[model samples]
Target: MHGGEPSVHFINSVLVTVVVALFVLWRYRLAILGGMRRGDSAFLPLPAERAPGRAVLADGDIAAREQAMRQRVAAAWLLTTAICSLPMAVAYMVAGKMSASPTYALALTCSYMIAALPMIAVSLAWPPWRMVIAFVVMMLSFAALCLLAGIIERSLLGRPLSWKILGLVPLFFDIAWNQLWMAGLFWLLSWPTRLRGVVPITFAAVLVFAAAPFAGSRLTAVLAATEVGTPWVYTLGLNGVFMLIALPVGWLAWLRLGKLAADYEAKRFSDAQLLARTWWLMLVVTIGFDILAGRERPTFALLLVVGEIVLFPLVNHWVMRWLGVAKLAAAKPAPTLLLLRVFGYTARTERLFDRVASRWRLLGPVTTIAAPDVTARTIDPGDYLRWLTGRIDDLFVTSRASLDAKLARLDLAPDPDGRFRINEFCCRDSTWQATVIELMLRADVVIMDVRGISAARLGCEFELQQLAKRLPPQRLVLVVDETTEREHLKAVFGPTLEQVRVIEIHRRRDADRAFEALVDAAGGAGSPPDAWSAGKKDGANQAAP
Candidate 1:
């Protein structure tokens, strides 16, 4: 034989057989583990607890229903594993019988199929102790089959059985080598991070390719010494090809197993439905691989591999859609209300500002004082009466402005005298600053307007500093004129001004633009009003033209 070649056909057949066998092992291991955790019995039915005409579920009844649901999921995974493995088992049997030489490759396929039987039985609703016993029995059965096949092959070849037994030593090493790497890959993938899964799979591929030559040397030596007929170089080459193919298949199997366990734990669907879907999908892959493995034509086999890659994801998507087990959608957040605290000098100035602020209804509801008294503590009785009348007039103006802004009807808090209560308090009062801070904390958004101002009062500056320190920068909106230099604003407001959102209003035309910017900075308002309010005010001046 050229280059000491045994047979390319035999090598291809062995590669295909081992690939299917590994899939079976991976799938059933997961199935058995999932079944064990679901408990041993079906959920008992709950006693009737509803009234004659109404249906009300008790706590215990709910628990019973949940238990029943889990049992069904466990049963489905187990059954699916069994049904899926059936085709692979049959394929192994047929391939072994058809082989002309009854080589150790055929024996390996038969032995693996035999080993999988106990695992399938354990997956089917067995208790923990029984499952452990079944696993032990499986290991013993595998060893016996391997020994028997080796002895039979040696006898037919007129060679000593000891030589065949020595070859079987490498099978143990193969199992350990594959298991060690897979365990490491699983551990890395299960790390708690966004790209944990992606990183491990990539790492596994790199590791496999890098370590292939060394691992292939050991595998080839063992097989060649055991009279498997293939030369060391050809055996090494075939092993490299097999590992390359197996890596992806093994990774996918691991992922599916993980998903199955998660779904079973979550009770996302009934077990029967999950089982049916898994079984059918597994059957398709098994049959496809079986045909590809037996193909004498390299071109057809390559085409089949390409088709499997292209079609699998589409099939999986369809199955997930049909099962109603697609990824969960993100929840929509609730709308927020923005509280506006407008600061200015006279009742006229506040009224003009209120008209501009009312347009902010598009963002959210705007709350502020109908009339702000800057010197309430120093005013005489006569002056108080004049201030009260001006406040009443401003309230009417604000109501009309709210209507124009298309805001819902204004619902101002009124005093016993039927006047809208002013949020402003005497700056001299020691506790007034604390009250202001409390209000700021309760508001989702706080706006401090210093338009047309040359300098801020000590009290206003204190309030701004407290707001900056307590509230997040994004939640505070600072409205000023273009004349307010960024450097001066930062100096007057302290370090907090640097973080607060600043919206500059230089002219009447800039009012709308400033308001829009404020809304954007404040993250926008919740629900908009259906219609604007319609109240009439006397002696109200129109906003600056």
Candidate 2:
């Protein structure tokens, strides 16, 4: 528009938009998806293959809700991607006309601009009463930014940008560009929302480009400064120095807040309570980082602030994930994944940001529902047992209590106070310690929850022979999930394996026949007598499947 070459400008803008959109889409892809709870780094990821995992069911209980929940999360991720990119179209046009010889700079400038906006606007996604304070702050930021930009650019560049302050810095510093973008992004990335774009990764790719022009420039100054061009190096270094201090501190604040929220929620704090408190903690960290460092070493402090603001979440997320996996020593593996994880980890972390903001609270509504609200009331305890065995399956619900109750009903389960007890545990949470394996050891009759469980080490059949040997001569109850059970049953069981009794549990509380059979066979004690199965008649076939 400035040059009046509308066609050329249009073409360039199109490219810019495409590039910026791609970066935003990829950079925040994981966050968008994770917001729906697909890959809960602290818990576990349900398989995304879309094929049902193992299911142990009786005759009628439905237990495929886990699958559906995962899918919904994936869809949410896709939606987030859409929301983030829709706002970046403006930046792309500006980038297209800025310059093209330094493509990387052009891209970086566009990306920074694009990345910058949504972070500021995020405060608006919520209402003003609860979120109002944050939004007002953002608005003030926009105002102050306008004043500063006018002084800086008009005097410095001899021209002025419209709403330049709003364009660069988020007015609402707490949920401003850096904080909101990073927090919201991390919240979604850690789950299984399905955002299939290249934006998140594109940002990383841009790093390579940024570093290209300055390669081999970080040499020891004393040894070479007198000979060649080291000033450029110094310039780059100086710019970097400005970002080191405050940036890191800001980022750390975010990480700490998120991790704290997750820790509290897992301990069973009401979600509403958690949301309300988290906002205060987030604000404290924001203001504290600024007050403590923003005033002392203003420039370096700002650098640290910016650095922390941008990088801390990534570092913290990686650390948290490593901790969750039970690694004795934390390892920094993939920076890209860590960055993405930080962007999405917030959904599980906490919601203080939404709570304290007076105007924004409406959009970030948190309902305090108890466990009963999320329960599958229609399904009974017996049906839960069947569902756990992969007998009946639905992809829409999860009943933690039902599953827990099934395991608790078994006499063979470890003592609740004992070290081996895994009641209320899932293989998703651990690869080796599910209760199904323990039940195989001593109980003559087991009401196994096969819903969402697998048959391999990560499933119900983790340790096969041991399961049979633990209750040798007593029947090894096979509770199979309906979807995959048919295929598995034909393979794991045979006629001669009389000690193996495969009971198809239907609905919850429909376990009467299974209990009665076990009782009659044990003459009341629930133990299998000698020659319970086809005995040694099929010893070789005992190794079947």
Candidate 3:
């Protein structure tokens, strides 16, 4: 067999695929094992009742806390940029024999931080749509930043700077193939899918590597004829490709470091073990990127790169610790949030969940039923992929034993960011009713969004009856809208309906009101004896997650 070393694309693709696949499978295995290893009862014991601290935390109080977290997230995003970019700045400074001024280095770093601010805001504003936003907002913002950097650099070098530099923005992104890579890579980076499926991320990387160069060449050739300097085009293209590949690798490595740190926070390992694990993961990721980027030989530059990679994680860990994510979570009780909704309300249901989930750690974890259809509403890529691959049986619980096992292992803990997950009960037609009853008993507070509820939704009707029978009215929040059939709902609950807290939400403000009611029901710092039950019959508010 006449064979040469594998092409860069082939090697990179293989490495990405293997790394991603193994990580996904490993996480999946851990999930299954977690479920099996739980020897507790099918549901957690109910939390003991406590006296209400204050009459339901004020809306402003909750808002202020949420705002604080957003600040932390923004700060973390900027810090991440600084950690990765500063190392490169140092390398450039050294390579240029100190020709790179500290002012310029500071300016470059400041430019990156400025560019990232808008994206961070966009991400925080709409987490569910972050992937799409990254594609549009991130690329445009990054292009703008590059243009500004170009202007500054030209001015510093005593070279001509004009509107012509704008032409080179597209030329840089296109010729460097950054535009293509950003579209795919950013989507992967901002993936809303909690499963963290690598199929799309790696697949996109491979496609970009294989196709961007040819496409970029034709596009740039056209741009090169439009009064832009040929030298600038080549320079940007040459430098941009290295960063195109390296950025994603660095970000991916950060993701791994996060997982390890989370395990440490959760007491999965001691200090020494965490250090060892972090070092091993960082080494593997750094070396993998180096090899894929064609830096196979040992050199001083490579050594510097290694040091940068090593320092990056240390900074990451420090930032996380400083943010007090673990300490904050530890102080809060992660009560189970039981979310029940009318079937076929996927869009509204997800919007509801997104609203509450943003501050869920303040209350507790969430539990809900997996809708019959998988949509972007709930990013379950692993479940969606399995469905596509005809592994439908794996998506649903067919037996009581399986449902019990699922409930036993269900985690009600917050993630490293102090955000809790919506643990879904994927049940078959035969077991959903039973699932509903068990979840009702286990929930600290039940949020049932019966918007558009009608006589025909027998399953929702059944859930209503169980909620009325098992959960105290003080512990339940009923969400309704104009579409809901009130008479039918009243028929199911009888006199009990009078005591229940009801939120009629036709707008965003109503959702905020509803969130407060749920917090009161969950017995957080602000629950009054009748805080939620006041005016039970008047219009109120609702959500699904």
Which lDDT values do the candidates have, in the order given? 0.38, 0.30, 0.54
Model 1 TM: 0.25
- Per-candidate RMSD, Å: 29.3, 21.7, 12.7
On TM-score, who's better, 1 or 3? 3
> TM-score of predicted model 2?
0.22
Model 3 residue runs over 4 Å out of place are: 1-74, 92-99, 114-314, 361-363, 372-395, 456-458, 508-510, 524-545
For residue 189, what is the lDDT in candidate 3?
40
**lDDT (tens digit, per residue) of candidate 1 on 29-134:** 3432333234333322222222211112123132233234234323333333333334333443454354544444433343323323322322222333554685
* Model 2 ranges off by over 4 Å: 1-241, 247-251, 254-465, 468-545
* Ranking of all candidate structures by their TM-score, best first: 3, 1, 2
Candidate 2 per-residue lDDT, tens place, 1-545, comes to 11223223322333343455444434333332223233332422222222211212222111122123223322322233223222222232332343322222222222232222232223222322424464455356544544454456556656655654454333323323542443334323311111112222222222223332232323323324665545544665644533543355445544443454344324322222222122222222333233333233234333433443344334323332333321211111100000000112233111221211111121111111111111111122222323323443221112434334544443221111100111222222222222334333323233332323334423334344334334343333333223234434334433323445433333322233343333332222233332323222323232321
> Candidate 1 or 3, higher lDDT?
3
| Clashes per model (N, Cα, C within 3 A) | 2, 124, 8
Shift in Å, residue 85, candidate 1:
81
Clashing pairs in 3: 56-526, 56-527, 57-526, 353-545, 503-540, 503-541, 504-540, 504-541
- Model 3 Cα displacement at 482 (Å)? 1.3
Error of 1 at 190 (Å): 72
